[model samples]
Target: MLTLNVVNKELCVGDIRIVGVSSASIFLIGDTEVVSLSSMFDTPPESVIIAPFVPLPTEE
Candidate 1:
C-alpha cells in the first residue's frame, strides 16, 4: 500500500515498509514493495480561486 497527502502549502506522503516523501505537489512511486500506507488529508475551502490550465473550446 501507498500513503499520500494532497494539500495547500505542502504535501506529505509515505508508507510503512519503505516509502516516504514530503513537501511535493506530485509524488513518484517507481517499482517498490510496501506494507501499509497513511496520509494527512485536507479539504479545499470556499473563496479559493482555481484556474483551469486548459481552456474549453468555444463555438463560433
Candidate 2:
C-alpha cells in the first residue's frame, strides 16, 4: 500500500497545484504529484481518505 507523509519540508508546492479546498485554505496537489506519490507504494491502497472541508474566516 502507498504511504505518505502528512508533512514535509523539502517538497515544494506552487499555488496552481491545489487539490482540495476550504473556505480559508486550499490543498496543493497535482496529477503528477499523485502519480509520483503512488509509486512510493509497492501495492496500491483500496482508496484514499480525504478530510471534510470547513468554513474559513470571512474576509472583511
Candidate 3:
C-alpha cells in the first residue's frame, strides 16, 4: 500500500539538451509515485559473438 499527498507547483525549462537515452531508460520531469524498470537479454551462451569494431554507416 502507498499514499502520496502531492503539491501543486510550476515547472520551467529553458535551453535544455539531452545526449542519449538507452534501452529501458526513463526521463521524468515531474512528480511520480512508483517507477519500475527492467532490462532483460535472454540469449543462449552459444549465441554470443565477439567481433571487430565496425562503426555504423552514417549519411554524408
Error of 2 at 22 (Å): 6.3
> Which residues of candidate 2, in runs, are more than 4 Å off?
1-26, 29-52
Residue range 1-60, candidate 3, lDDT tens digits: 466677869988676555544444567787787877665568986886645443444545
lDDT of 1: 0.46
lDDT of 2 by residue, 1-60 (tens): 677755544656554433446534434443334533222434557664446665445545
Model 3: residue 51 alpha-carbon error in angstroms: 14
Q: Which stretches of candidate 3 lie over 4 Å from their true place?
A: 1-10, 45-60
Candidate 3 TM-score over all chains jointly? 0.43
TM-score of predicted structure 2: 0.19
Best candidate according to TM-score: 3
Candidate 1: tens digits of C-alpha lDDT, residues 1-60: 456654445546575332333333344444334434555547556655545343434545
- Whole-model lDDT for model 3 versus the true structure? 0.63
Per-candidate local distance difference test: 0.46, 0.47, 0.63
Winner by lDDT: 3
Which residue runs does candidate 1 get wrong by more than 4 Å? 3-44, 54-60
